[model samples]
Target: MQLLFGIPTNKYSSLIPTTFPENVSQLMKVFFCLHYSYKYNYFSISCWQSLPYNRPTFCELYEQINKIIEIMIYIIWNQMKKVILHWDKEIRDCERVMLELTIAQNNQRLELEK
Candidate 1:
């Protein structure tokens, strides 16, 4: 989880807390930061269940993590599409401007030759 998100820290300390309360409660508080997605929060909370049996099994965790990855990929793909389209339009506009400028320059040369 820390690999996906990051190590939790508070205003008081730059390192991980040594105590139990700080490890659990303080960690949860840090997870509330805007950078964490809802899926990450839910997965982290489920894994932290006090009872071992209550926590997700390895298979379950794998499936949940895959789902999160798929969702992220889908979002990123859509954003990339939008960015590509925007750049495509910008390039076309620049080309049109350049063509117009070239035509104006050619017409000026023709006038000068007359």
Candidate 2:
């Protein structure tokens, strides 16, 4: 998810879902900002624009950002180890539909070959 969100969206509204717990939401925002700047080459411009406010710019917030990233990684790793998981059935259903389509195509191919 972190890796994929860097791509430009067709519309600005195509953001990651914000339905997670508050802590997770905040962590995701920080992670997104970090990943976006790194992947898209916008760090300097982002930092400069944010300077007018007292907010910590990317460079200045390096250590704290890294700490947050580490915390997020630790939380996810622990959950994975415990087999704690959440499944989005909509995505699973989409996968099932694609698989059914592939099988149908293969069956059609076999019939035509016969």
RMSD (CA, Å), candidate 1 to true, equals 8.7
For model 1, residues 29-75, the per-residue Cα lDDT tens digits are: 55444255786676656665544576679998788767666866897
The 10 consecutive residues of candidate 2 with the worst lDDT sum are 6-15
Q: How many clashes show up per model?
A: 0, 0
CA RMSD (A), model 2: 17.9
| Highest lDDT model number | 1
For model 2, residues 15-114, the per-residue Cα lDDT tens digits are: 3345456885665466556663464223322332322463345576686567666866987899876663344566688899999999999999999999
Q: Tell me the TM-score of model 2.
A: 0.28
Clashing pairs in 1: none
Report, for every candidate in turn, its global Cα lDDT versus the true structure: 0.65, 0.55
Q: After superposition, how far is residue 44 of candidate 1 from its true place, in Å?
A: 2.5
| Model 1 error, position 4 (Å) | 20
